[model samples]
Target: MRRARVGIDVGGTFTDFVLSNGADGSLTYFKEPSVPSDPSLAVERGMAALLDRARLEPGDVELVVHGTTLGLNAIIQRRGAAMALVVSRGNRDVLEIARCRMPSSYDFSAPKEEPLVPRDLVFEIGARSAFDGTILARPPVEEIAELAETLKSRGVAAVAVMLLNAYVDPTLETEVADALASRLPGVLVSRSSQVWPEIREYERALVAGLNAYIHPLLERYYATLTRRMGELGVAAPLYITASNGGALSVDSARARPIDTVLSGPASGVVAAARIALLTGRQEIITFDMGGTSSDFAVSKGGEPEYTTRTDVGEFPLILPVVNVSSIGAGGGSIVRVDKHGVLKVGPESAGADPGPASYRRGGTEAAITDCYVAAGIIDPDAFLGGRMKLDRAAASGALERVAQRLGMTGEDRAAQAAEAALSVTTAKMATELFKGLAQRGLDPRGFALIPFGGAGPTHANLLAEEARLAAIIVPPGPGTFCALGAIMADVKRDYVRTVRRRLSDDGAPQALAATIAGLEREATDWVGSEGAIVEATQLSAEADMRYAGQAYELHVAIPAALGKTMAAREVGELFHQAHERLYGFRDVDSAIEVVTLRVRVVGRVPPIAIPELDKTATAVEPKGRRRVFHRGQWLDVPVFLRDRLVQGQGFAGPALVEQEDTTTWIIPGWHARVDAVGNLHVSRG
Candidate 1:
């Protein structure tokens, strides 16, 4: 009668599930082909399959933590519900004038992002608030009624209200939103301050708008998901993973869907961070190469880096999220020769339905996965533990077409094309990785690359070689790593308030302390309301500070003791220290302004135990040998079963470690060994 906690991650090509036994901490993984039309269907299927495989009844599940890309897909695909915007009279073009920056500064012809709410659907009201929380004007009841009627007539499913200076005082805007909701029943209304109360009007407006835009779609989807789970008789509290590498109650996610939009990659990063902590690695870069794209995130000192600004499609997201960058193509990225005779690896993906040419699902184009097959790097018969057999001939044919386009005439033309395509893809990823690390003032040589996702380990060695990385850590169950991360997530939430005042100003300390105290109360209350999911609660604080008259602000963590005391001099010193760390020097004489205060509440869940492998001095034997293409030549490589290798066993490349979900390729110049926890550590010779 061992209860289980299930974690799920819905990806573009598959829905991954991990069932953790509550007593023994044993993990069982499953992956089901995704249903893009209805992602929830894939979740249900995967859950049922996982439970059956684990020999557990649905009722034995204690909790379910799930992450999905539904909201993210909707935003990227522009298929969300029609939404309208309600703003103060003078600020109608907030989305249109977003930061007044072009997608490309050097390219004058670069088009601007299409506004989420069209100008015709943007209704302006007389409600306005001064910068200091004073209500300047309030829209009349008649005007509110008229606006509601107009919105209803326009057939918009939701409305986002973003009055000017609403962050200062949300009451006026909330009142208007309430009135509108009352008049227009069934239409979802999201207030700017409620969604995100940051100082930037444009960012705040987009947050509310994005939330409203995806509300109806997610609400319907979740309703179906909840009903399905109940029908299965799980009777577990379902939690949704969030962008900040944490979990939130499903109801909380429903209210603020914006937080969950970037949850997929963040969950994987969280898992990588935890793995780094357990493995005693100080700095690691996570590489998640899935079906559609490859994402990279940096973790240092066992913590994932976070950023306050990231992009969702063409829109800027101001919420705090784990900093993950989409570097290059993934498994299904199409490979083609352009009209100018230049070979390209995708910005376009084959996706799940058609998938790669080797999937035998009607795709005819050469994709990265197809190239793997053509190059003989992936054994077509052994894919997915032989559950899904790939079509090698079709893959070879697809690559042959690309080779013909490139005028390759050798008998090994297809294999050569595949190797070349992989080289191109690896180069692209390495370049982007270097650029991302450079922006953070980091060097690739200082960090180990932790590769996950279905294809991450298969291509990790190539990436590591191209990027000149120090090492690669291939985790167990790499394909379902995101799902593993979801179960390991803690209950967390963030709160923010703007307090624009110089550190030396009169009563600044008292104002900062008051704001922090209020935010802490709110955070604790919210965490408390989340039920008994966590064993303990912790609070952390950060401040957005900068030199007076600076164009930008830097986010600096505030010590817990200093946060509680709110000493102006100490906080100013923290900002100065951060400034000097980022830039070479700090202006000690310059006045520091604390623009925003942020508080995070984390409810710590009981840690999951990672089962260690049995130590053995015996040398591991290769299950078989295969010919793999590398650098324009085919070489015989030893293929080993990943599960059969025990701890304290060492091996050298060229070798392949195959498992049910993925394969790890160790190139000729690298050596690999199994750690105590079953992670394959590969390093340069």
Candidate 2:
């Protein structure tokens, strides 16, 4: 009897599942058209179908890992619970007064994202604390009870508690939360300190409120998922991918669903890192081009970069998550020429139902996928292994319409028009990639591009060329890589605390000791809840510090044991050196202020190594030849079967490497070789 591990990833256009046999290390993938109206239907139906295809009993499954985009979609679409906010008195409009800075300076027509919590639902109580952590005022017991009753009577779905200086001391905050829970048994209650114990009242409040807004929706979905898994008799503990490029237990995930909003794309980045390490590559960029959107992430040394202040839809989250950036360009992204004679690819998508014109499901507009078929890069007869036939004529006709607008003729001009449309989309992605990397001082030439999604490999080479990247690594089963990532994520969580102090021991001894102690206590509690997954936890501590009177702060990593032996003058010298390395200058004569402290609590999951490929004496052969449009001409290209390619097998350019799940095209002057882990490594001569 063999046990199985199941991983499921739900996308806007398709739901994919991967079931790997724990006994044999054998893998199987299944794809089903996603039902966007009710994503869970696709999950349930897809799971059953995948189990049947793998010839495995659902009872034999030992673990089930899932990655979803439901909360993210809900926030983006502005579809979630009606929530109320509870703020310290005199700060009734903290949300409305966010940052007070416009997103765009040039476009006056551009509007700011609407706050998730409206003005009427915002209630204030008399709770106040000074920046120095001194209590200024506190609400009476009767007043808090009345406020709770008022919130319940107003029919608010959830409540958010955000008080000034709550991060310094959460005792009063917890007292209020207890009162709310007792008064309104069903209404969800959250405190900003419990969610993110960091400074900046507006940002911290938003995190808790956003969690409350998406709470019920995610709770229901998780309940259904758990029940469905149980009905199938799989009793193993379930894990869900988090935006931090790690997994969390079901209970923890349910409590902090906001942390999982961006998990899906992050998973692909994680999988890319794993694949890169197997191929002995250190610098890599992951390109995930799905149906409705495409995303990219940069990894160095097999670790994804993390950002603490990334946006979730229109809101900002104060937790650390893998930095995966997305743009509106994918296979299902609609393309049309504007009345101004300019071609536009997407900010709008045909989505799954009316998916590209090539899908032949009532769509009439051109899309990037349609261009792939028109340019002959995708075989019309072998789409999804012939499971679905694309209407090439429809795709060509749609391109012709755009071509006519540009006054062109012949298939050559039509293909050029299609490529032009794709060029615009690709250039948009490249520009975004450049800007993001520039912020971190990273270069594209130092990174290998790994593409995975419906059209990831198809577009990887083009994007890499534009970005001037050195190489490309197309992994096995590219389209289902996100599911593969979910299966690979480890259980983890993040912790932080705000400490305003000078680095000198005499000036900030009490503050430094208290902050470190508080962070350790929080990290210990979180890691303990993770059970055996955290056999030995790793803790990384850093301080957000700046020169006195400086508005912005720079994060500086500090030794975790600094509290015991480090002298005040020694710690001050450390800050000066760290500041010089980051900003090119240090303020030796100026005073330093510690704004905040952060700790990352990581729980290690058992490593899942890439399975070794069988190196038998069999030569991988091309299925056939097809004319592919490239470099202003059509050339007959050899399309080889990916699964048949053995380890150490090398091939040259002008070839299409086809697999059951994806296609990788090796351009002219490029060579590809199969590694022991069965990844296609493409590099220029």
Local accuracy by lDDT, each model: 0.92, 0.83
Error of 1 at 398 (Å): 0.3
Assess candidate 1 and give its lDDT: 0.92
User: How many clashes (backbone atoms < 3 Å, residues ≥3 apart in a chain or on different chains) does model 2 have?
Assistant: 1
| Model 1 Cα lDDT, one tens digit per residue, 334-393 | 999999999999989999989999999999999999988987778999998898999999
**lDDT score of residue 618 within candidate 1:** 62
The TM-score, computed over Cα atoms with residue i paired to residue i, of candidate 1 is 0.99
Compose the digit string of candidate 2's lDDT tens values, residues 1-685.
Answer: 5378778898998888888887778778878788888787888888888889888887777777899998898889988888899988889889999988787999888888788898998999988877766778878989988998889789888888998889988877887787888888889998988888788888999889888888999999889878877776667678888889888888888898888888999999998998888888998889999988989888989999788878877677778889888899998888888889988989899898888889999999888888989988888877876777888888888898889988887757778878888789889889988987898788888889999997899888888888888999998889899998988777777778887777653747666767667777787788788655445677777777788899878766678677444345666777888878778888788888888878777777666556788877566678889888887789899998887888888989888987656678777888888888788888887
The weakest ten consecutive residues by lDDT in model 2 span 563-572
